[model samples]
Target: MNKKKPITPFGWAIKQRLTELQMDQKSFCELHGIPPSRLSNLIHGTRKAARYRQLVAKLLDIHLTEEK
Candidate 1:
């Protein structure tokens, strides 16, 4: 079964922007020097590595506000 993987809100935003730019995760990670695993953690809210998360936001030109 090819089930759709559920994405977190942050991941959704990143995915939307990536889709608009026609960019893929591996390419984006390589371009920005972010390790793929870290990116996964950030998008999933698994790890709060502030520096790397900030870098991703900056590179994507996105502003991430507090969830609540």
Candidate 2:
């Protein structure tokens, strides 16, 4: 069976915004003063997005609600 990687809604949104901005992960994190590991954790579902969602949303100019 082929399993798809898990991604949260916030992660999806952040990725979309990153693509829109033409920014890479390392540059984005560095420019925003966000630790790469933390962002990586959120993207890969290794950590709860709740911890970093707000900050990321603000940085990405996205509005995120707690519904998902």
Query: Which candidate wins on lDDT?
Result: 1
Candidate 2 per-residue C-alpha lDDT over 1-68 given as tens digits, one digit per residue, 9 for 90 to 100: 85645877767887989999999889998998888988877776677656566788788899866643
lDDT of 1 by residue, 1-68 (tens): 85434556878888888888899998999998899988887777777778987888888888888762
Task: Give the number of colliding residue pairs in candidate 2.
Answer: 0
- Tell me model 2's lDDT, rounded to 2 decimals: 0.79
* Model 1 alpha-carbon miss at residue 15, Å: 0.8
Candidate 2 residue 51 Cα shift, in angstroms, is 4.9
Per-model TM-score versus the true fold: 0.83, 0.76
